[model samples]
Target: MTPHILVIDDDAAQRRSLKTAIEALGHAVHVADSDQAGLEVFRRHRNEIEAVLVDLSAPERAGNGFLRALGDLHASVPVIVQTSEGATHHAVEAMRAGAFDFLVKPCSIERIAAAIDSALKFTRSGSQGKPVRRARTGTVGFGDIVAASAAMGRAVELGRRAAQSVIPVMLEGEAGVGKEMMARAIHATSERSARPFVTVNCAVIPHSLIEGVLFGQDSPAGSGEVPGKFSEAEGGTLFIEEVSELPAHVQTRLLSVVQGGEIEPAAGKRPRKVNVRLILATNKDLIEEVKASRFREDLYYRLNVFPITIAALRRRKEDIPHLARAFVERFSSEQRLAKPLVIDASALALLTGYDWPGNTRQLENAVFRAVVLADGPVLGERDFPQVMAHMASVRASGDTAGARSAVEVGHAAAAAVQETIVHAPNPAPTVESPAPTRAAASGDLSANVIISTDEAGNVRKLAEIEEELIRFALKFYRGQMSQVARKLGIGRSTLYRKLKDYGIDPDDPQKHAA
Candidate 1:
């Protein structure tokens, strides 16, 4: 069904432009000249209308009253406010009064479209009333979450369930999988939405200062300079990222918060009561850490009350187009680029082909880099050379058996493009070799070949095989990363990552070996 949108703007020309633009997006537009008229129209067609776009400056009492009234009336229908330069403060007040988001005057078509898209999503969310989509923020929300894969859908559902409770939520994922963003969304939808939301990076904060940074002291100045995150996030949320990086003592203190629901400052003699909804994120498996004694078992159990595992970017290839577009729009707006960058099909295909080792964060950064470097309005395959290289390698490797593992794919791509004409024994016991041995063959492609295999030649892990292949390629390429990477069927970046992972130094490994 076509989404219905109500636009309340006094300017006839502006209303026509908005209606045209929104209708072009396949949404039915209902235009009203004033807030009262808009409300009457909305009341008559409440169920049909999905979203409201209002000019905050048009209404009486500076728009907050109008927004409050709309919220009181519609309750669930999202209301987007538009403000001019001097009305930015009023816009903030409107948002606090339950406006979904505000658009500044002279806002670009892209920005307005993004805002409406978010609003429509929010409106749909309210209609669905799914518990998982509780995080309703002006920015990222469960509704705005770019998840096309089943894995991510499940994660979002779990996150929603976790948001309904005040218990600690533990998000486990790779480093770049947007754990912090998800935490924010969870907090935004939770009952503590009105309270302060604080974040603490356990990995970055100084070891000695962490305790005082978390648990506020009783006395002034000497005891604690500022209110700790617990006190700062009172009646709100405290999101602790890289929780596994916390020192043992700090972990113990956090465990106390989980168990006792109060904090005992190092300098304070008494335990102080603080109300905070705890949300912890980690890139490691806490259960494995607990088993290895690296993480406290009790603390892990407490935080793991509602565990959410985020799927890495590579596993959800279908979401690449959506995520890339979002990033392009977001970064384009941020950079103040005059024209929005458009990713061509070839560029998108390349983006979807490679395994993003750093996950969503890496893709976002890559898109940002592309947007920054891109000269043309249309971002072509050349706009992202790294993705192209990896895509080239991955496709080149598909000629043989399906080698989906990054390492194996890299090796297969290398084998496909390598100039050495090296040969290996028949991959299967009964299968004939593609090329004849030097003894039986003329000096053709078959004659100049050496069998590339593991030293043991038994069934070894693909990683071990890839390491040997990479070593051989580096030797053959003589430290030329481009040649080596191309031969290996991987991006130079991926090749570099593999080198670091395998500790392969093309130039000076012997010196560091000792």
Candidate 2:
């Protein structure tokens, strides 16, 4: 099937080039040279255009504003962004504002076509030749967790085993680790697979009203009463999240219900019996809470009867590549884009090194950002701005460490030179010539370069080499002096001295032009 695409760029040359490239792939293409013209084209062919490709650097209109316009237009039609080389943060923001995918500039035609295909596949999931799976019964199955890590695998194994028993299970982990998903999986695998799985966020419920919410409350005279989570979950599973946030009184009440298989309703005339199984989750350390006397020891023991601790993302860095691929596939399928939205190795490396303080949730956001901003088939390091920035900082820090090591080695070599001079025999104050002016080995030289200019012609070559190094240093430092000094292995003052000696101005307009 021919996929219709709209290409938006302020550069007429780029717009024409992209339109021709996309059309060459047997797809229909529409072109616009400005954001306003892009919107007009989108509105005119709203139904015909399956996707929109927007330039991130388009002038006279902010990318965010264009994204908002697209959102307001075909809300469901995919909008792919074309971003500059290093503007990942802008890409992420565009994703948050609803871009479908983004591509970096100077991308190949094949890559652009692939991105369009992936986006189309994402939007057309289950509509054409998609596979169907038989739904599993009782507790929720391990299907929703989407993990490929050994740590997560072990946790799922434990959960499956725990499902065989009717005991109350407690899941401990940081937020966004998919604890609730695991809880449902256990329920689906257990005897109560057909029963409803009710979930309640303990932290969201007020302490004063938690008892009524969990155990039901009777109506006033002549009024109807409502059932609480326990009654709603009868013959099923009650999954309580943020369990550690439950007040002491609520904890005691919950304990009685778990132990007795019954609960007394608020304003109750009689105690009601329930046959629901219980699953509790918390991101807190219950042991510490118990020690601090903030949580009930008895309640902890009751829920801790079957404990499963979910692993954090950092501990499972190896799973990132898989997760990233999965996310790409998911978003691609949802947006009706094409398949196998490949991520280049550099992009994958950036994702793997991220600290991921938000775990799976953060990873999802990053993937979504990449998909929305990517203009090509493959996602690269520039697709996720925050992640790329963090990775850059980490690399810069590593570079500094390498420089320090080099300086230490240089200092030790100088000390050895002093020792050699002192130990020389028949020291008649012989004057030694300076070291030969040979080209330094490629890798070993620090930022320092030896320039030998005789009375003539060497001046031009020396000037050229100095200009190149300065440009390299400036690019490496992103035009920051402190960073340039660190990369050059010179103190800030010494860098200034060299800059003057080389007849270069630290703040020259030509130097910072790029």
Candidate 3:
């Protein structure tokens, strides 16, 4: 049977656009221009509809009432909330009110495709009345993760080793760096692969209730019982997010669980023995947290037994193109396009050049937006309006560093010979001429080589010639670090290091103006 999607929005054009996109994904779509009409459509075809994609900004909906109304009709079907960028607060509220997922407007088709697929999967997994656990739930393996760079590869390799044992592993990285995904991969590959994997976000839980949430609460008057996260992951893996935010009391109890493999639910209750692997994550420096008296030192030691630090997106820029291309293919396939879309070299360069502070997640979202709104068979610079807009803004603000880097990348990509579309079979690999070095490529450097010998015809030190070339390139590129670095075949970080080593002021290129 074909999966059905119900789209509700007040704007007629948006409703039509969404319906077309959803139908292109091989799903039957039902559209409603208003909340009341949408409810009628859902009620009429309730069982047929597999998922609902509704806009939360509808004037008639009146504060998540539409979502509740849809739930009232049929609670099993997933509801994906959509809203304009400004309505982020409302979107968060809708999530709290049981939204399967929330998307900001102008979102890419790929984002929509991924969300719909996940929602349907969630529905199917929980169809048997078993509650679906969001601990990424035995889906992701190490192979599923994209680790093209050595930095990320190291982190993944460490995770693989940690999976061999029940050692409490700690993942340290900036927010949105895929720590949860790493944890899930560890669990999926571990000996307890068949058991449950439960997750608890310590940051969001109320401080007072965190203890009961992690350790399970005793029934009042000794009646029934509420199982905490620890109990839920018996013989499996328990992933605690933002472990640094855990209250001191909870930390003490958690330490006991780690040390003795048992948990005491209440003050007077006897310790209940349990077997489970632990994975904790934090965005802050655990040692600093301990120094500040915010986290426990002993508990930290136990969790940090097998620490894996995932590098930030900026530090691993080499992986951006790979991750972006993967997203493009995934999202394009999900949209069910007759022909797969390919990202233009310029588009790939623009993506690779930008520093994704939000890490791989942000890059994925960017690609999703680009793939969704793309009109032609190829995604170009115009397709990524947000990225181009940011570069434009940077240029306008006189921040030559970032804007020039992106421009340089675009220029380099313009000369790239490869244009292979992903998933294309029997594609012949093309080999090209070796790329010219920075000195050869630069007009000034190509015209004349720097003198390697001193006035007396004696050969100068290697550092002298290298520094002269760098200085010449810096001046030639007019202090554009990205262009200089790329033309020289080095990373931006390495370029900066060399600049500092040579005491070359990047901003003062006039020193070598000749």
Candidate 4:
């Protein structure tokens, strides 16, 4: 279908050019000479217009002000700002002010058409809409997480409420849960959405240099230095992932940043004040870490002011079908499949029944694998070999001795089993007990037996499962653990233990090898 486009520019030539190009694409076009004219056109044909292409350099009117005004009009029309040469900052400003996309001036019709296509796609998909004046621009919203389960619904509600406040938000979940996604959603729904949403994976960076990377370091004697995540996320959010991994000294500095909104650079430099909303995520139990004296109690309280725990995927199994469909749709679009991919009931059931150790990430990977491996347009149970295997293991584990079925009751059951096996109960159950029998029924028992000889043997099976789940959750949550855990329904401590146990490092193996 031909999309209706409105071109608004002070320059008659620019307006005419854009109008002509838009029309040439078989789209209906309208022209407005100024911001006033654009608003009038928008009002007159508000229903007809699909998008507005505005010139950022329109005379006498600040592009930001114009965009801001349009935002105030409650116009759902996607706005694409046209920028003059060397106006990169202006484009970003426009984006901050609710412009859906930007086009550099002196560009060919091809580029304009491409930008329009992208903007229209974004609009039609309901991805970006009317400017959320008070909402943080890039902060993730409920739409981003795509959860339908009651637990997930509550978590999302909490996220929205947390976003409305300025308090530091602490997200606790398993490694594969969509923590970062939730954090981003909170940012998107917050007042700081228009500003940068900087992320610092605490576990990824070296412990020796976290402070400098997070707070920024001063330039050496003659060289210039740059600001770090704190300054970069000024007026927006500083998302710290795996926050429990932060060293005690670094935690002190981070606490100061969160409490006082300032950080002193290295080499005795003066402290620089910033206005970044703090969003911390950890798969580890900070409370436990605090007890162990590894995490600062003060810092914990500061971040815990607005604590949000994401439900694990297994707990929110009801949302699996929807999530699976979303993933299939996403991958199918990305891959440009000949036909839209469909997931049959059995395949979806297979997905819903399995314990997603990796949470949504694993689910997405399973879907991606199914999409890629499928010979037909529809994805069937056979397509997800890993998912099927996991399902079999879970079923077998549950049916073997029926000792409150660890695989069926979710992570709580697994934790109970782990405690039973590791702590050595008074009656030290024999192999005939439901625990060992169930473990044996599940293929994981064999894997556990193999790793039992290792120093970390007891944690091995859980670690491997956690690693797989985290990796899987990464795919769906796009590596955001809070969301992964929320979808998975496990505590962050459980998630981290698995990561450490499995040794599934996120860093590039090639770089390490080199």
**Model 2 lDDT tens row, 40-114:** 988888878887888774323338887777767646776677654334335445654655555544344543665
TM for candidate 3 is 0.54
What's the lDDT for all of these models? Answer: 0.67, 0.66, 0.70, 0.65
lDDT of 2 at 100: 54
TM-score of each: 0.53, 0.51, 0.54, 0.53
**Candidate 3 lDDT, tens digit per residue, 241-304?**
9999998988998889889988875667778998989999998878768867998988887888
Write the number of the candidate with greater lDDT, choosing between 2 and 4.
2
> What clash count goes with each model?
5, 45, 2, 42
Using lDDT as the measure, the top candidate is: 3
The residue ranges of model 4 lying beyond 4 angstroms of the native Cα positions read 1-139, 393-514
What lDDT does candidate 4 reach at residue 395?
66
Q: Write the per-residue lDDT of candidate 4 for residues 212-325, one digit (tens) a residue.
A: 888777566657676688878888888989989988888888777777777766665677788888888888778778868998998888889888877667555435656876
lDDT of 1 by residue, 1-514 (tens): 8889999888887888888888877889999998788888988899899888888644254566666676677457877777543344455455446566555444444446666787788577524423232222454569768754334555676788888999989897789988988988898888888888899998898988888788754456466346788889999999998998888888898888889888875554667788899999998757667756889988887888888877667544435656876787667666767665656545654565566889999889899999899887777778888876775666687732222322221222222212212221211111011221222344554333444554797666778767767776664443445557777789754776677778875333221221
Q: Per-residue error at 250 for model 2, in Å?
A: 0.6
Candidate 4: Cα lDDT at 401: 27
Model 3 misplacement above 4 A? 1-138, 220-222, 401-514
